[model samples]
Target: MTGDAEPASDERTPGRRRLARTVLTGAAALGAGLVSGPGPAPTATGSAGAASSDATRRRPAGPDTALRELAEGNRRWRTLHERHPDETSTVRRALLGGQHPFAVVLGCVDSRVPPELVFDQGLGDLLTVRSAGEVLDEAVLGSIAYGVLELDIPLVVVLGHQSCGAVSAAVHADLTGTELPAHMQYLVDRIRPAIDPKLRGDARVDAAITANVLLVRALLAAEPELAARIAAGRLAVVGARYELGTQWVHRIG
Candidate 1:
């Protein structure tokens, strides 16, 4: 269903309309932006799989490969054939000393969208950073830089999802002209620009969520160190969203 059904006559009241609009728009809204080409993933230097010399012992072969692997994993997850790879005792032991994750996943703090589970990644496969609505600051950017500059992670996936509470709250607050709690106000304020003020209800929230993903994608891609890596064909930064009902994830930007 498109979830665009008109409300009852009485439900068209301002408060009722606001409530209706606050509901999240699902995968129907596809966020848009530029998606950079993938780059080669750096070699794993740790002792775990380094000694075996098996390609599977390490992360995916390259940035493009990493993205492809995630897409395949999502297919498995949605199909109920999740490989759930690389969680064995030996794999855990190998990761004890250090981690050489293939990708850095920046996702919302929403429980349903855990990067590893949604992408079907194994232990040490992803460096995940989550904030309400995926908002970023100096610290978050610093962490991402560490993943790129230090760990040499080849892919950065900004994962948003359907019905984000944070985005919904921001949309509702914006439309109602109500300020949230201090810290929450900060988050809603950051999310405002991504949404159009003229839009109301679910359309507003859906648009904001997509905008948030693309905005974050551009922000990370423009980071000085990350920009260098992208220019050198050593990184790929992408924006994607997870469909709650379908268990599928697709790139939006």
Candidate 2:
């Protein structure tokens, strides 16, 4: 969750070794492959083992309590502390056929803004979608709806970040008539309406980021399936911003 890289295998403790073995065996049966599309099957236990091993090392708790845990984990990350718990093989093997992630996050496509790292979560913990400016386009909305209705994820986070380049571009285009390419301009066009004309300078950027987060939250809450779940008190949506310099997230609502 801290966005820190995984520790070396030699550094792993005895408990971690046992867990890794379990995850690997399961991955073998499931025909686990890399993040990329399916390729050749794992050749040896060592290869298959690496997949589950990595997964076990990163696996987090169920979705029901994931958000609260994420907030707590972020605090630990900011404090430069490590709990260093190991995910057991039993748990890893059991989860091969199914997973129940707790929360869904709509974040920006910025490479530096990975939600798992910022929130200090591991694999299988968050259902994540990334789009430039965290914009609410049809595809993005559909993805969120799928997570809510099909996955039954309990919480949705609209994560905008500080000093977002996408928001800045939109602001610049609004100030000057300089035309952007049709495809790139589409992104600006979506973000432009979220900008508060009353605000200018740095405040303009900040307000635009916050407004976009709110707008996305509203859009998700208004989706028929998502809206019903929210009204029934079965789901919640919130907004936040990740500060690049500080490597921390501040909740906006």
Candidate 3:
């Protein structure tokens, strides 16, 4: 995994090219805010199958193994390395009917930051929910609840990344009182309360991002169904920050 932010269109198919272009063009409108600042964009190498296999191999045993697997995957990713696994026709055929994903990842909607690629997961390995800033809304929280209460996903990860534009916007709102677009403003509102008032200056954006992740984790852990599972030791909710410079996910509180 490389630390740089690559265009999301690079890995999509030709049939989806036009759609992707439209998506990229209207990213902000779609409420998928852009990434701020700059770093070397990481290039995705190897086939999806290979990546998935590596993810599967790292998976922990039982219904509650996602946290460890994710940690290991991030380690592999940080080194500009991958443990490519073969995605054979048999494997594809086997997954035709259903999927039993081990973990549910609630992440930012940034195109440069796709959870599957970052975690090196393959088809049917993860249940992913994405929204700007990883902010918790009724619908987003319900989706995560479904994964836990119904799908029985073992782990829930609130994944934030460095240089997140959504977070930066929230920080801006906190400091300068600048308002964001109407639709996107909700994200700021949801994340705003989580921002640490004591923290200030340029680095506040990064701090806000991590703060939001911690907030999401707390929210998930407190959710009724999720809370039950957690109390029973059947599930875990963890917060992580992905470094754009190293392509590694740093586990935070």
Candidate 1: list runs displaced more than 4 Å: 1-56
Separately for all candidates shown, the number of backbone clashes (residues 3 or more apart, or on different chains) is: 2, 5, 6
**Global lDDT of model 3:** 0.65
Best-performing candidate as measured by TM-score: 1
As a TM-score, model 2 comes out at 0.71
What does candidate 2's lDDT look like per residue over 133-165, in tens digits?
998878888888888789887778888887888
Note the Cα lDDT for every prediction shown: 0.70, 0.63, 0.65
lDDT of 2 at 113: 91
Q: Tens digits of per-residue lDDT for model 1 on 7-63?
A: 122211111112113222221122232122222323333444443433355467567
Worst 10-residue lDDT window for candidate 1 reads: 11-20
How far is each candidate from the true structure, as Cα RMSD in Å?
A: 10.2, 15.0, 12.4
What is the per-residue lDDT of model 3 for residues 12-121, given as tens digits with 9 covering 90 to 100? 11110011211111111211111222344345556664645443444453433455466545555555555433255655676787667788889999997888888766
Q: How close to the true structure is residue 60 of candidate 2, measured as C-alpha lDDT?
A: 34
TM-score, every prediction? 0.78, 0.71, 0.74
Off by over 4 Å in 3: 1-59, 84-86
Sorted by lDDT, highest first, which candidate order results? 1, 3, 2
Number of colliding residue pairs in model 2:
5
* lDDT, model 2, position 44: 34
